[model samples]
Target: MPEHHSGRARRIPPTLAAGLISLLAVLALLVTLPGTATAGGVKRPVHPDRDWMGVTIRAHEDGAGPSAAAQLTASVEGVDVSSHNGSVSWSSLWNSGVRFAYAKATEGTSYTNPYFTQQYNGSYDRGMIRGAYHFALPDNSSGTSQANYFADHGGGWSRDGRTLPGVLDMEYNPYGDTCYDMSASELVRWIGDFVDQYRYRTGRDAVIYTSTTWWKKCTGNNGGFGSVNPLWIPRYSSSAGELPYGWDFHTIWQYTDSGPTVGDHNRFNGSLSRLQALANG
Candidate 1:
């Protein structure tokens, strides 16, 4: 009655408005944090650090390999690193007896490691046989496209003794479904596409990096790749235990994630000369 009636929004108290803004900010941050829930209620990390080689396997599988002490005694020791390792010290790794390395080069079809040159070349400069690996994301793009992306980046190989064939790191999906929503047959086809394209591009058969559990679950233990692609099997146990269906032996066995100086440690399942033979090929 006192004032002419006109609808107007009321202003909130300063303290309440500030609190509301702070809460909203926190919610936004949580959405992007690693392992936080995203679309479809899947905990996917928005950042690439969580896409490293063994991250999914470590998150999903459980096994204790031989003691790190026992595995460290192998003569042909190596390490695998990604951006998750930042700028690694290759000299320290070489001094610590790391003779070979694999660095993350690309992922999916869009993402390339920011530190690829540093890690890939640094290892070679330090006299370590080095290669690049591509982390597969089948659902996002076709395997041939992803392989082209990888080869165009640092994934190309040479017959020099210091360069190893590029690696295809196929494992559990870190972003969403374990198999990237692809059935076993679909995954096998995708892998076939990738390896075929990679071979066509690089002139060397790409090495296959996968865990036995993942190999069996995602590819139905596909035996077709064993004859052509070298297998790099991850097993944190005393033995690589029965390998996937086709392979009778593992080419490179990643024995422990908690390596001494820097990255995950692996043992070449052969002598140093044999390791050179692989690189030479």
Candidate 2:
């Protein structure tokens, strides 16, 4: 969710370069985080209340980062999060009209979300359907290892509609190499291994979250994943972008990484019954 338009920053410190920008970011972080203790004696993580997470995404007429959401039709709106969102009050988010969520659970085989337990359970408590995601690092570890790590940690599945299937986030590499330097055929093989292991472990196909460009360049425009997995595409400008190489349609479209809530905004492309069917399996 944090990756949008190349200005995305996972947190505040890493992206601050200009002196004035750093000063303003400090001021912004200070202003957003406040005394957040519950009356029930529960302490919460301070939300880094960011307007645009340091990037300039001027989508709406107001010139803010997705300052306004498109008036969606025949769809169920949702949101997603990672450590980038820090601590969030999910109940408040649910009241804002999000029906489901996807939380970044693990990256590769080594990294795990420090805030996943709180966010996952919090979403369920607030009556929002939730799913866990794994940020793929095919170069870092074997696909089986990373998939197992994700599934073992918080990526498990259930029949309850409150829980969605696991998602695999394969995008432009955040580090240095975008494709992890894997050849197109190699990339395809690696992804195949991930899906195979994910289905073997969870008994459900993993959702592939990617952009059309990345799919074409990294996997040589391979459409093989379409058979075993549903597609989730991230396109900020409009909802009518070309579907990736893998599928005829996307089940979920993340229209914007900026929303009225703590994470990137998304929507189910079909009716609630179809969404429920996806969740049931």
**Superposed model 1: Cα runs more than 4 Å off:** 1-45, 65-75
Candidate 2 structure, TM-score to reference:
0.75
**Relative to the true structure, how large is the alpha-carbon lDDT of every model?**
0.85, 0.74
What are the per-residue Cα lDDT tens digits for candidate 1 across 1-281?
58775698778999999999999999998886645665655343356665877877777778665545474465598999999899999989988888999999988766789998999999999899999999887876788998999999999988888899999999888777899888999999999999999989999999899998888888888899888899998877676667887887889888788867888888888889999999898
- The residue ranges of model 2 lying beyond 4 angstroms of the native Cα positions read 1-68
Q: Which residue pairs in model 2 clash with each other?
A: none
Among the numbered candidates, top lDDT falls to 1
**Reference-based lDDT, residue 132, model 2:** 91
lDDT of 2 by residue, 1-281 (tens): 68456666555464454766879888777654432334443222233222111112222112223322556766898888887787778878878888888888887665678888888888888888889988776776778887899899999998877789999888765444668778999888888888888899989999988777778888889978887699987777655378777598888987776565688888898887788788889
